[model samples]
Target chain A: MKGSANRRVLPGYGLSLGYTIFYLCVIVLIPLAGIFIKTAGMGWADFWHTIWNARVIAAYKVSFLTALAAAGINAVFGLLVAWVLVRYKFPGKSFIDSLVDLPFALPTAVAGVSLTALYAQNGWIGSKLEPLGIKVAYTPLGITIALVFIGLPFVVRTVQPVLQDLEKDTEEAAVMLGAYRFRTFRKIVLPEIAPALLTGFALAFARGIGEYGSVVFISGNMPMKTEIAPLLIMTKLEQYEYAGATAIALVMLVISFIALLIINLLQARMNKRTISA
Target chain B: MAGAVTAHLSEEASVRPQHINESVLVRIVLITIALAFLTLVVIFPLLTVFIEGLKKGWDVYTASLRDADALSALKLTLIVSLIAVPLNTFFGIMAAWAITKFKFRGRNVLITLIDLPFAVSPVISGLIFVLMFGAQGFYGPWLDDHNIQIIFALPGIVLATVFVTFPFVARELIPLMESQGVQEEEAAVVLGAKGLKLFWLVTLPNIKWGLLYGIILCNARAMGEFGAVSVVSGHIRGETNTLPLHIEILYNEYQFSASFAVSSLLVLLAVLTLAVKKFVEWRGSKWQSK
Candidate 1:
């Protein structure tokens, strides 16, 4: 009945698309807009003063640094795990593969409490390490451990597929030419997977910065010391500092959005390059 | 002649490309490090939950779980997941159909917005709802006039859960649907199938595994969600406390055994989630290979 130019073969486009937009607007878009609108109502000085306070700045530092440390740790171990899983065959390999996703499947609260118990001075691992004057629980180190638990799968999962699809011909050629194993890997394999690694690092970093439930129990919420950015928002909310919470949330939201945007752009570029190459 | 053949074989073996792979020692070392790290970081903590939960023995474990407040929190968690999972599932299916089945502008932007919640802090996820419906929120006065409660109540809990889980189902289905393409659906349509028939017969079967996979993830998060639900829950004991929040309550009360006992239930759920996820993935891959 309609013009052929605009005609569609299948139906429900309007019904489905309309529902999608409406739901997106109500459930996500409008609520997020509330954050911006609430912050916009705060004047410039108040806004600056709220987010720029010493405590908030300290929280930002802890959050960023711990998340960075956690992401860094995950990048190393995650790469190792991904490399092993792809390159080797061993006993219980599939089981170990599934275990990498435990953090994602496990509740954050459970992870937080369990990690705390494991790391507390009197707890299992903590007791052993206590003799060496190492305290993990209730410290930034504990926070990094929790974030590592949460962000571990991101790096492995992201890099696993890329590694799987990597062509072995180049590596074989390099070895045939007498290149050493390490040198061949460093030159051939690393470049092929660098984008994926960077994407995983960015993903893990973004997740670490925004992490909440897992970090809280281990963090001990020691204000300037152990408190994370998300916990600060929770504290402000509890104290009925709606404007302050809004401002902090706004800042976090923006940073996370920008990080996600960059990752998406990077992935798109990688996908295009992969298709072309 | 036999001695000469043996010497030739030995020489060829010596000239083989043994440098391509890591030495046996190196492989063993790398695997050992990966396993040791996973043991300390993942497996130990997972085991700790159960061990600590039962430290006070089975009697205490069962007694803590049978506590009235614990049961209520469990009920609330189920209720919230019941409402939130299906709603998000419906939204997920619709959004995936739209984004994948048709060519449209701003598709990438739409996908990112759906994923927005993942990048946002869970605390902020809850705070967003509070800002919209709290006592000082934009519609605060209106909700008050109607004797309505969104923040610090059931509605607020559900909203936060929904927001936190908004992307799970859609994220699973979009790539799946995109990869499957529209050829099958078009063929069904051309053969006189229409609307619901087309979907039920064609689309549903194709996407069911993915949809179920999404629901599994969404349900796990919905039930286990703490930070977002914590913000709006108000921690009203047996009234507003979900299971995760209840665990926090018991933990704060220094009822260490009781808290871990409650946590063990979610641990069980998490284990179950992983098991089912493995199944779905297996089935999906099998189907794809067909």
Candidate 2:
């Protein structure tokens, strides 16, 4: 058996591998290369100034912080929701499960408007919230609300399968050994789900950073204030500030790329450790 | 005597720990909270917008579709997606077939690369094209030499779309193809079937649902796509504006009803896609269970 040839039935390599590289080049690589080449022409001093200007800097703070906040919120509650959907037996559980993806399929523009209408000062929930001294519609809070709306699916979807696949017997065994709920979760469950949670967080954060459609309708697009990075890039393009726009985009590209790479690596490592265990 | 009582209490506790047995009151409260979250987040905005549009009577809502700007914007969106999705589907199929049906080095890498668009925000995808084709971009001079109109036009819109949607079809098809091994193909081969006949007969039937699912998802995203399209499109009113762009224009011009009216239409389309997706997934699972 060991000596026998056991080649898989699918096609062999070489040609398809070459084609894959070529296809990726035409679609992804060349385009990124072109962006860099355009940016390369800009003097570093100007690039620094354009990207660091008050407006751009504000956009950065709004986009990065809101995205982080949104991802954090999603991580906590999204996990709870996933846990409920996976571990519970209840009526409408299936419906709640399907609803996780509703955010993914909903158009962001519609999502933005919908959120604004609900959270605007005069809007339904906003009218109620206003008397409590919490403003949402045109503030950074609005930005976070929009980010959270779009980012919800990432964490839920990422963590759900891991939760579902987690065997009940492990928890049972820990309980029999006299471990507390918190201890069992911390030692047995949290480690299993942590990497996936991190991946979801990174993805949600990346999406939050690049969100434009939802934020625009709600943010009021206030310059040096409520504007997000994506909106700023669009502004630069509209204003004929190509260098300005691409420069901002380059910074985003580097940060998001590095963040995504780390998350993906962590997910792989976690998966490997799980397999080995 | 106290030790005996304590031992009895410990024995009973060991038999069953006291738990928050989720009173009927608690369950209702929790359910209400969930419902409120859904209604506020997903349901209310959509219902309100559509209701407002129709509040002025269907006559006004009906006439919005006839607006020159709205019509042209729709026409552009339809045309661009019509071209972009099919082109992408072909690439998606080719990529999926080549990748999933093959065993090779870098296969995992290709799979990840294919999904790059999913994680890369559509806004970035749109900007990448602009960086490739904008007036001051790297390829702009070479492209401008040919007097080509790419960015800020229909071509630019299509290119941006093609990049953003590149993953959907391929992603949809992979799991379907993977779960379906080459058993049928091997059978076909043993029967001396080859080439197009083999693909059309043995392969197509097994994976048609996935292909359709991917195509529909791709189309829905393309049709409503705003962030990426906004970046690449100049939003030159009726010229480059797609349906989403048109809605923004209407909203900005203070034609609130018309914007929501158009958005109502996009929502309907999304719902249609969602239905089809459910149907396809349902169909696939049935086959699996069988």
Candidate 3:
């Protein structure tokens, strides 16, 4: 068995492996290293000065707060959408089901402009809300709406497969013990899908944090108000502040990496739990 | 007696137990909330793209699309997708083959690395290359010495698109190829099939649906890519702008009708992407059922 581990059962392994690694290095690894390599040349004071400024701090707050709100909204609605799709039958279900993926398919730039069109003061939805003294376009609220559009699919897609696999037998047994439908759902079903919901929430949050195309138009790019962390990087680059841009980008990259690592660990734990259960 | 009657009645009324059934009010409430939310978020903006695009009439819409800058942007987008998608596809196939077909050290690490681009912000995806190839970048001097331009040029756009889309095909194929196992390929090899022939006859047929699924997604992202391309593109009006960038320029210029018209085109692409995706998933499931 030990020797079998080294034995080749198929051909082209060397060719494919070499090509894959070579391509990965050229396309992804080397470019990513550029971020670190550029940032490494900066002194600690310069790096901190670039990243810890009022404008940069504001951008991070805007990025996190909007992303957090969007993900939160998505978690609730996404779970409902998944549950309704899986548990109930209705007209237009198929259409709605397909539409759930629109965010993934639609160009972020198109979504950004379309949403801006809809929520601007004289635009469709925004016209209806303006009398109430609310402004959506070119504000943080607009940014959240765009992020919501971007992140909506993440939560629903992640929760759907898990919700579908849930056993009806458990709910049936719970009901047979005289529990009501709501109680049965809360006590029996919610626990099962909790891990999936969390994963979805995290994914949506991470995506929203980095989202640029969809948020930029609606955000108005007001430096202290609606500016996002990614936009700041772009602003710096445009200003030829390569070190400053690299510093902000490096910090954002590290945070994104940490978030992704957490997600991987969470998914692994969830898979193990499912197998054991 | 009551329990038996309830059970009998429930059997006729529905397939599940009586107590598990939500009241009609609850079900209606839940479905209403879900549909309303979808309409507000997904449906309205979609409709708006078409409505505003044609707000100035068909001639205006047509003129805007036929605008030289618009056409060129469309051409550039197609060209970029044409190059980026296939290279990534080739890489995807090779990566999936290596990861799934053989037992190797660092396999998990390789897979995770493939996924790294997805986690990175699209802005950062562009910045990495700028840091590599921009005038102030590591390779800047060498490129300048050679009189070559990359960061604000076609090469940079292609590289950024490639980076952003690196994982799409591989991500789709790995789990699929893993599930299909290596037995079929091994059997084909034993029967004297080798190299390209074995892959064409055995592995390719088995993974065709998955591969198509991957390519469709990769192509969609490649063509629709905005952030990464924007960063590298100098936004030369008729020279370097892609469709999305063109739309941005038009919108920023207050050419609302024209901007929406151009967006209408990408929206059409998005719709096509979804339809093709649905068709492939249906076909893949049907093929699996066989």
User: Which candidate's lDDT is highest?
Assistant: 1
| Tens digit of per-residue lDDT, candidate 3, span A1-277 | 1223543778899999999999999999999998888889999999999999899999999999999999999999999998777766678876788888889878999999999999999999999999999999999999999999998888888878777777778888887798888888899989898888888888888888999999999999999999999999999889999999999998898888888888888888889878898
Off by over 4 Å in 2: A1-20, A178-187, B1-32, B141-145
lDDT of 3 by residue, B1-290 (tens): 00000000011222344456677788789999999999999999999999999999999999999999999999999999999999999999999989988887899889889988878888999998889899988989999999999988999999999999998888888887887877777777778998999888898888887788678878888988899999999999988899999999999999999999999998888888777767767776677569
What would the per-residue lDDT of candidate 1 be over residues A1-277, giving only the tens digit for each residue?
A: 1112332678989998899989999999999999999999999999999999899999999999999999999989999998888777678877887788788878899999999999999999999999999999999999999999998888888878777777667888998898988898899989888888888888989989988989999999998999999999999999999999999999999999888988898799889878998
Off by over 4 Å in 1: A1-7, B1-19
lDDT of 2 at A238: 80
Tell me the spans in candidate 3 whose CA falls farther than 4 Å from its real position.
A1-7, B1-18
CA lDDT scores, all candidates in order = 0.87, 0.76, 0.87
Please state the CAPRI-style docking class of candidate 1: medium
| Model 2: TM-score, first chain | 0.93
TM-score of each: 0.95, 0.89, 0.95
| Pairs of colliding residues, candidate 3 | none
Error of 1 at A163 (Å): 0.5
* Docking quality category of candidate 3 according to DockQ thresholds: medium
Q: Put the candidates in DockQ order, highest first.
A: 3, 1, 2
Model 2 chain A lowest lDDT segment of ten: A1-10
Model 1 Cα shift for residue A151 (angstroms): 0.2
> TM-score, chain A, per candidate?
0.96, 0.93, 0.96
| Model 1 interface RMSD over true interface Cα atoms | 12.2
